[model samples]
Target: MSYDELKSVLVSLGIPEDDISPEASREEVGLDSIAVVELALVLRREKGVDVTEEEIGGTLTVADVAALVGARTPA
Candidate 1:
């Protein structure tokens, strides 16, 4: 999952596309606790990425989340 892909997922989750950037914080992009969980489920179920909410929740910025997903994503 690249940064753009993760940003698209965030957009689908109702986050404003303009609010998302590589340096943007998760909270700044409206990624609350519930959103974190939903993102995890969406990634796993829809994108077939095996990421957990805890992992996503631990991230600080959008880049961090993208890196986590990219790391877990198979090439």
Candidate 2:
């Protein structure tokens, strides 16, 4: 998926779309630890993709998170 599409999903989760960018830092996404967990869980259940905490912990950009989800998504 495109980065823009992934960023839009984050935006829909209450994170400002503008706050998301391939270059933006993870902190810029404003997702607290709980929020991160919540998002990972949401992606797993809704998209049939499993994103673990370790993956979330290593993500620094919105694109990274999206990449992780995309990698785990069924083909």
Candidate 3:
């Protein structure tokens, strides 16, 4: 998925655009547990990627999420 699509998840959650970036950590961008769930749900429904809470919990940055989702794509 594109970085814009990933950023949209944060935008949909009302997070400030300036605070989001591919390199920004989830905590640095104010992504609480609820936001994480919302992100996971969005990725699953909109991007067709199955992400676990534990996976999201362990993420250190937005790029990490992108990589996680990208890596899960079936070949």
Ten-residue region with minimum lDDT total, candidate 3: 66-75
Those runs of model 1 whose alpha carbons end farther than 4 Å from true positions after fitting are none
* CA lDDT for candidate 2: 0.75
Candidate 2 lDDT over residue span 2-75, tens digit each:
56666766777889877777777778878778778877777777767767877887888877877877777787
Clashes of each: 0, 0, 0
> Could you say which candidate leads in lDDT?
1
Residue 43 CA displacement from its true place in model 1, Å: 0.1
Where is model 1 poorest over a 10-residue stretch in terms of lDDT? 66-75
User: Candidate 1 has which clashing residue pairs, if any?
Assistant: none
What are the per-residue Cα lDDT tens digits for candidate 1 across 1-75? 899999999999999999999999999999999999999999999998999999999999999999999999877
User: Which candidate, 1 or 2, has the higher lDDT?
Assistant: 1
lDDT of 3 at 9: 71
- The positional error of residue 42 in candidate 3, measured at the CA in angstroms, is 1.7
Per-residue lDDT over 1-75 for candidate 3, one digit per residue giving the tens place of the 0 to 100 score: 667767777788889999998889989888889888887887778778778777988989988877886786444
Q: Point out where model 2 deviates above 4 Å.
A: none
TM-score-superior candidate, 2 or 3? 2
